[model samples]
Target: MNTFKDDTLGSIFFQVMRLHHIRSHTLMGMQKIHRGQPPILGLLWDKDGRTQKEISEELHLQPATVTVMLQRMEKSGLIERRSDSEDLRISRVYLTDKGKQIKDNVEEAIKRLEDECFDGFTIEEKLLLRRFFIHMRDNLLKVSEYKEI
Candidate 1:
């Protein structure tokens, strides 16, 4: 064994996040959606036809970034941007049929990943882990300007 057997909390947090990113990417690839699109897709699935500005605010992303992602997703046939008849300035995003099909696929993928990640973990351990993760998130939010939503 190496002298430095790294067991730091920050290291573990990074390892978990990295693993989740990898898994999410693989899952999205299988579903034929971009990695960044799931967050948007999930938002739309929960409430279809949200404007880019609303999405940017809800996801805490820049409007410019959301615009770029929406363009890519629209080209992929996953979403459509429509002009708001009442408010021409605001455009609402709607999911295509293909995008609707992807909802269940990604949900299953997430569940599969969760099961794999938490395999053999007891309920108590899982609860404790969730609490710790939330606490860490709260700490991060405090350091930044983001408030709990």
Candidate 2:
């Protein structure tokens, strides 16, 4: 196995993040879901009917990107879009039976991934690590001068 020549924190952290992303991508692929679709699905699961604009804003995704994702999801029979009863201009997205049924499988896959990521870590250690991550995130946000993203 190859090892990093530069042992800096940033380099190590980048490698960890890359590997985590790759693992997550593969895990999601196994569930027949795309990389960015889980969160959208989760949102819809939480509230079955939401407008496209709501989803886009809530997820902080570009409207065009959300449109494309919704298009693909609609084509795949995972979600259906319908005109709002009160407003014809607005479209609401609702999960199909397939989409609703996949919730359990998607959740299970994520849980497995999380378990793997925290393998061999005690409960206390996990809690501490979570705190450290939150601190790191706050530090970055402060330096970037973005109070909210």
Candidate 2: stretches off by over 4 Å:
1-3, 143-146
Model 2 vs. true fold: TM? 0.91
Error of 2 at 149 (Å): 6.0
Q: Which lDDT value does model 1 have at 55?
A: 97
Lowest summed lDDT over 10 consecutive residues: which window, candidate 1? 1-10
TM-score of each: 0.91, 0.91
Expressed as tens digits, the lDDT of each residue in 1-149 for candidate 1 is 33235568767667778888998789778878778888899999999999998999999999999999999999999999999989999899999998898788888987888998999999999999999889988889898877864
Deviation in angstroms for 110 in model 2? Answer: 0.4
The whole-model lDDT of each prediction reads 0.88, 0.91
Clashing pairs in 2: none
Q: Candidate 2: what lDDT? A: 0.91
